[model samples]
Target: MAAELRLLLLLVCWTALASSRCEFPAIFNFGDSNSDTGGLSASFGEAVPPNGESFFHGPAGRFCDGRLVIDFIAQHSGLPYLNAYLDSVGSNFSHGANFATAGSTILRQNTTLFQSGFSPFSLDVQSWQFNQFKTRGGVAYGKGGVYRELLPKQQVFSKALYTFDIGQNDLTSGLFRNLSIDEVKAYIPDALAQFSDVVKGIYDQGGRSFWIHNTGPFGCLAYVLERLPVLASQIDQAGCATPFNELAQFFNEKLNQTVVRLRKHFPHAVFTYVDVYSVKYELISQAKKNGFGNPLRACCGHGGKYNYNMNLGCGGKKKVAGRQVLVGSSCADPWRYVNWDGVHYTQAGNKFVFDHIVDGKFSDPPRPLRLACHKHI
Candidate 1:
């Protein structure tokens, strides 16, 4: 009788300890500028002030006025803010690290879609870097061996959350190259295949929990609205470019299908396909209710209908009416606008999306984001 009682106590204690363990002790993120904390800034010294003026008070390498969605996720999970994989100074790997870089694409060859040249850090390249990180016992190879800590301890990597928010550049680059809509659609399969390969690679390396975000409503971006005159008539009553939104919707639909296929392939893996488009579109569709006064305009940039001047770029200086002025002038009230500098979201906008994404319905596996950290526990 005493032996059985002791056994019961032991089992109860073990279960309690397992439940009490910190939820999602670590997180590994991969994507482009949308979630880049500082990789692009560390590499090229871009994203300078007033880029991060709103909240960070200085450019922290985020392509926004403040935090990215990843930052919010980290905060909610009780993990420390992620350090960019390339940042050399003041980096902490106890939680995990971010491998995202501005301009990263799903396909390596997609770089040719741009006239400036190719991006060296494709999703495949990021995957390779991740492999290197594992081989070196958590030490990152490039950017002066920025991360030196023995991270994602062999056991931690299996329980960590792996998040991905890429492929926007792939489609955008095709559009910039003037590819027909059908041609651009044709690229979806290849992009999804590469995405699958990336996830498989991570799975092979012990990662099992995933939080993936689909591309948002790119057509609603101030930059796209300014550049695509043909889409002018497609603007709806709410001021969103309908045709471009349709493109985004199509891409998201295909992406969701791909996620379904991946689920079948990795039956045991937890794949959370976050509906970024729906959340972002909701904000746009009900901007007034969200406290946003100008959902269709960018908070920065100059010399265009949407205040997005491609030639001068955001924060660039140019002669304006005799006096030299910053072409991409920041607005006095960033919170009132949804788009920032034509391409990215304002800090306020990102926060709204983060709130909805964590509400459970947006996540494919239908788990609350806060609970996702404890999923494998």
Candidate 2:
């Protein structure tokens, strides 16, 4: 009897220790181009240059020069490079899978007939990632076969964190395609409603934790600052594009409100709002401090009237009438430039954003559903 009691006590102690140190088993990510890792490249077979060239020395399909904010977060958390959930090329899921795609928006109406560059992931497509996991033996890698068997039986969904960074592309395509800033702002509430539906679907599927990001400052993008038509008739030469910024602020405020309501609806879910606007603004304001001289200068582009050619994306080979032209230009050093290809960032810039998220610099105002998953983490 004495020996049996000692064994029982030891077992109970071990269980407590293990639970205290339990780490998040997986990170399931969903967002737009800002968080995509070669998904669009795999889907399109086109190169976007100097893209992923800084760190990888070759195009790895990211929209930026090197790593993105997603990669940095994974790294800081001791996770490996996030695999594209669509990548049939690999079977590693030890870290997590990225479901984000370039040109994707949280809102469906954000899609327009006149402009079709936007390839935002629909909610249906986002759910497809779960189906992919089943094909991968119903388990994330590095967790062993025992966990695989347990995954289906246990509440494995509770041990994972879902990181979402998106919604910028919606406004981008809207404004550039000729919609006025005020026009786009008016559609934001409806767009957010659809976004909430997608989140609710995840909730029904047992997703209790969410890290969501709002849109960045669109008026400050190198592409907008340089190529945007000068509305000198409205705003003067200060170059801030006041009308455009006003719309961005309005969208961000509504997004915060949505997050708050989501928290209340699902008391068990933890929703964290990533303040991308403030993070990006901080970097742009301190560009000189970060060794980036001009935050609005695109690192990859030709020296045309607006420092860009519509025919050439960052990594594409410029051509005119079936004849190749070397019109695309690369920066001397991408590290010194924040904007990678007029719309994205350098690897360094992404790192800064990641640090802020992990540090919890802007998780305030308490969105109702956002606090659920945090208790376990």
Candidate 3:
């Protein structure tokens, strides 16, 4: 009788584990500018010409020459591109919704966006927005018909893959405020605590699969190089500021630890931590070897050594001889360049990073993106 009971328990355990492997029907993303589709544009204004010229053929609300990494992730999953939750016009939320906005941080800031250039829609606010989307979507879907075709099925929430690509802005928010590097690092724990809160909130709402991206090496970005200039001696072989890259590495270490803790806390949920910093650093450092142009220079800008002007940005106009002239124009071959406009990645750069990570080469637990739903244990 004892042996029979033990066999029954084993069968039940095997059944539970087997049921965990289902196709990911949807993707729900939360992040900053890196993954934003159109959330910022919907609130502010269009990203404007030459922004999406490479692949989109026109302005497509992305701060790039074309699609973002998130777009590629969706394509690989056989899911439609996620529409911005804020963008009401011609948006379809059947497969997923993007709550990311440019200049977003993991934690809310004390200063206003106009003052410091950070978004008010931090991780907490974004999680609250998700809750609202789920609740309101359920109401709209109950009527069926067009609503059913638009919003996701209620069960999709539990089965969806949740992706996060934030926390970079949190570090920048401190730097831009004239805080020392150590000062910025001091608050990272607080920032990550807020991040964990959002994850727990989502888990409570039945989100079981998580894909979190660590912040990239901002030292290689033209904007950071220009804003926080370091001595020539401090510049690494890659022409990147070593201090900043070191700081980024420290941040990534902490982020990895956070993911490990989360996995322990929620054994049932699958957490995938992606090392985006390494992938980005590799591309930027060896850009020319990989058939790319100047890695640090912007494809669209006004002037200066890095082809970037803080005063006027991409799609910016200058009054030349009393006439408005488009100064921040695109480079001849955008695909050959690594940086797009001093801040964000170009479509080519985005695709390169996606290609490397899509196969799970850079992800924790070493599982491919589409198979993120499966728990290794």
Candidate 4:
């Protein structure tokens, strides 16, 4: 009886120790403009001024006036902000790298960036880049000098947190292609299949923790609202386009189901399907209550019902009263508005989302980010 009791105690202790919170040494991210740090900018010049002005104080390759949610995630993990995997100048890969780019999609598009304004570096390409980084980083780390200081250790690949925030562009691409809502909805499974493949690829590389964010409420975005003229009757109570939001919800539902399927496939891996759509929609719906205003308008664009012009980006100039293209300007208070440039969120909005999600209430398994490695029942 004494021996049995000792064994039982040992098992309990072991279980407690084994199930403790995960200590992720690094984070490997893949996504679109929502989580992009600098991939698009590095490949296609700077993000322009007025962007990165709030926090970074200059053009820093980010679409927002300040940091993004991925930036907050890195800071919270006690690691430096991830360098863009494409950023060749003065990049430090000691902790991790971001492969997200503006206008990226889960499924690769057959169009060019100049033609459609979509990135060629889709999710699969990002995954390929990560593989290269891991493989090359190992070679460099083995050199044992400046290389060791600049790159991550070989073991960080398996122990790092893998975050994904793509899929919004996948929806938008279909819209731009003039596909109907049902048509866009029809292709979600394929996009999600590609997404799952990427996740599985990481798992194959020994990545065990996954954090995936669903697409946000694109219906509330100024770019979508102005570019796509919807019928007045189709507007929701929240003043958002109903068709687009419904499609986003459908994509999110299918994405959640995909995560469930992925969990079964990789028993050793822990998948956290974050419901960012709900959080974003809630914020937009109750913007005043959340201390934000003009949730649907862009803070840094001009000449539109929603203060957005597709041809004129945040820093792009537009002629006013036949004068020089100087009417385009940013809002005086970016923190007061939710939409940054009619596409991405402002730093304050990103901070709000980070605050709500870090505690894991927005996650499927209801476990904090620190405990994301543990599989829940």
Best by lDDT: 3
What does the lDDT read for residue 106 in candidate 3?
90
Best by TM-score: 3
Worst 10 contiguous positions by lDDT, candidate 3: 13-22
Q: In model 3, what lDDT does residue 238 have?
A: 92
Q: What is the TM-score of each candidate against the true structure?
A: 0.87, 0.81, 0.94, 0.93
The residue pairs that clash in candidate 4, if any, are: 318-325
Please give the RMSD to the true structure for each candidate, in Å. 7.3, 9.2, 6.0, 5.5
For candidate 2, lDDT tens digit of each residue in 1-377? 99667555644554444434435566778888788886777776635566678887787778888999888767755677787766656536555677777777766644533368777465446656664564454535346665543233235566677787777776776787688777788788877887888788778777777888888877777567665655776442334556666677788889899988998898888778868788877788777876676777778876654355555757556568999865666788878877778778878888877766554545542222213244322
Full ranking by lDDT: 3, 4, 1, 2
Model 4 scores a TM of: 0.93
List, residue by residue over 1-377, the lDDT tens digit for candidate 3. 99667555644544565544448789999999999999999998889898999998998879999999999999988888889999999999999999999999998996777888888899999999999999999999999999999999999999999999998898877887889999999999998899999999999999999999999999998889999998999899999999888888988999999999999999999999999899999999999888898999999887998899888888899899999999999998999988999999999999999999986768776666866888754
Clashes of 4: 1
Better of 1 and 2 by TM-score: 1
| Model 2 regions more than 4 Å off | 1-22, 46-48, 109-115, 131-155, 233-238, 319-325, 365-377
- Candidate 1 stretches with Cα past 4 Å from truth are 1-22, 110-114, 138-150, 319-325, 373-377
lDDT of 4 by residue, 86-133 (tens): 998999988889999999999999899999999999999999999998
Candidate 2 TM-score, true structure as reference: 0.81
TM-score of predicted model 3?
0.94
Task: Please give the CA lDDT of all the candidate structures.
Answer: 0.79, 0.69, 0.90, 0.88
